[model samples]
Target: MRIAVTGGAGFIGSNFVAFFCKNHPTDEIVNIDKMTYAANPMTLEFLEIYENHKFFKIDICNFDEMENILNGCDVVVHFAAETHVDRSLQNAEDFLTTDVLGTFRILEIVKKSKSLKKYIHISTDEVYGSIEAGSFTENSPLNPTNPYAASKAAADLLVLSYLKCYRIPAIIVRFTNNFGPFQHPEKFIPLAITNAMENKKIPLYGDGTQVRDWLFVQDTCRAIEVIIDRGKTGEIYNVSAHQERQNKQVLFKILSLLGKDENLIVQVPDRVAHDRRYSLSCEKIQELGFEPVFNFEKGIEVTVKWYERNQQWWKTVKDKDEFKKYYKNRYPGL
Candidate 1:
């Protein structure tokens, strides 16, 4: 099989590429990434050794380039997007351009492709906004609270439109929060792990009570593989591990794993329009023989150990001037 993966250098995308290449050595993988700040080539350094894997540094918004690269691909997995909520809140234009327009470009290419058999649109549970009481099913109406989620919701609707109007073979999978190796330091899990490792203060938003379901990235890769092979077209699948944790709880776990003091935590102002909780129903994907391999406890442990052993990796990202500036601007006195 010939597969094209967008954002293949980003966290979840990179992990998926490695996982797929290992499981399907004979399959050809064309990795497309814009090489944004959140993506480091080092994350995919080992993939260069894979004879069947190729990398292309191209933005998905470039229609001509995307069309040419994805021409004969049997599968196009769309994972490219400006995905940081905080960054989106600060400047929404990037998110809108990359998440919505970039996805449109990919869909356009898929609509014209005769060899494309499957177009997988990776979505997020944040599109459902927040659920204080119960979990959101695949059919739940999208109610995005932030600009990032709104952009993704728009892209999701666009993918579905192509499936209905142009008969494009597409599937959407909304995954819960994913954490593991190679995640950017700006993100919650990696930030906490790295900061605690550096003996720096861990920044917490508001009271740190916001709830999120944490799915291991490898488990996410497995779920995506299952969906690619067994899922039906024109369908949306909610993939989650049901291992929900409060922000403070996750931080505490990280501290425990790293033997750090709780006093290192410093609460910052709450994010604008921050959702209090996010939960998803995984029944749809589970029906397709998908199961999560890592619970939060095990995943968090593994993630902490990875960060501990790979200090040079996250440190390089944290040491960048761009990251320092963003961190200072976002946290101020923290």
Candidate 2:
């Protein structure tokens, strides 16, 4: 099978690319990444020697370019998006352009491709907004709060529209918070781990009481693999580990694992419109024979070790001028 993975250089995307390339040696894999600040090429550098793996630096928003590359692909795994919530608040336009427009462009191309079998759109649980009572199922009404979530929600609706209007064989997978290696340091898990390792103050937004369901990146990728192979077309699946924890509790766990102190955490003003809690009901994906292999504790240990051993990987990114500017502007005292 020939599959095209968009945003293959980013965290989850890169992990999926590496996993797919290794497991499907006979399959042709095309990785198209825009190389955004969050996308690091080094994540997929190990795949350089693979004859069946090819990398293309193309934005999904570019129709002709995306169409040319997506022509004969058997499947399109859409993982490209501007996913940072804080960054989205700072600049919502980029999110709209990349997430909504990008997905639309990919849908248009996939609609026209005769060889395409399925299009899996990777989405986030945030599109369901803050769920206080219970986990959000695939049938939950979309109530996106932040600009990032709004953009993804728009894209998700667009994909479903194509499925209904054009009969495109598309499936949407909405996953909870993902934590693992290769994630940009700006994210919660990596940020907390790196900060605690460096003995720097880990900034906590608000009282850090916000709760989120965590899914290990590998488990998420495995779930996606199952969905791609067995999921019903035009269906939406919620992939989650059902592991829920408050932001402060997660910070303490990271600190304890790193032999650091909880006092290292500093409360910061919360981002505007921050969701208080989020959880996802994975019954849909579970019914399809998908189960999470990585438990929360095991996943945390593995993730911490990855950051500890791969200091050089994040060091370069942390030292970049752009990253510095973002840190200076966002956290101020960091």
Query: Which structure among the candidates has the greatest lDDT?
Result: 1
- Give the clashing residue pairs of candidate 1, or none: none
How accurate locally, in lDDT, is each candidate?
Answer: 0.93, 0.91
TM, every model: 0.99, 0.98
lDDT of 1 by residue, 59-140 (tens): 9999999999998899988899999999999999999999999999999988989999999999999999999989999999
Model 2 TM-score, 2 decimals:
0.98
TM-score of 1: 0.99
Residue 79 accuracy (lDDT) in model 2: 95
Q: What lDDT would candidate 2 get against the real structure?
A: 0.91
Candidate 2 segments whose C-alpha is farther than 4 A from its true place: none
The digit string of per-residue lDDT tens for model 2 on 1-334 reads 9999999989988889888888789999999999999986567675687788899999889999999999899999999999999999888999999999999999998888899999999999999999777788899999999999999999999998999999999999999999998999999889999989989999999999999999999998899889888999999999889899999999989999999988999999998988999988888788889999999999999999999999988988898999999999999976
At residue 251, give the lDDT of candidate 1: 96
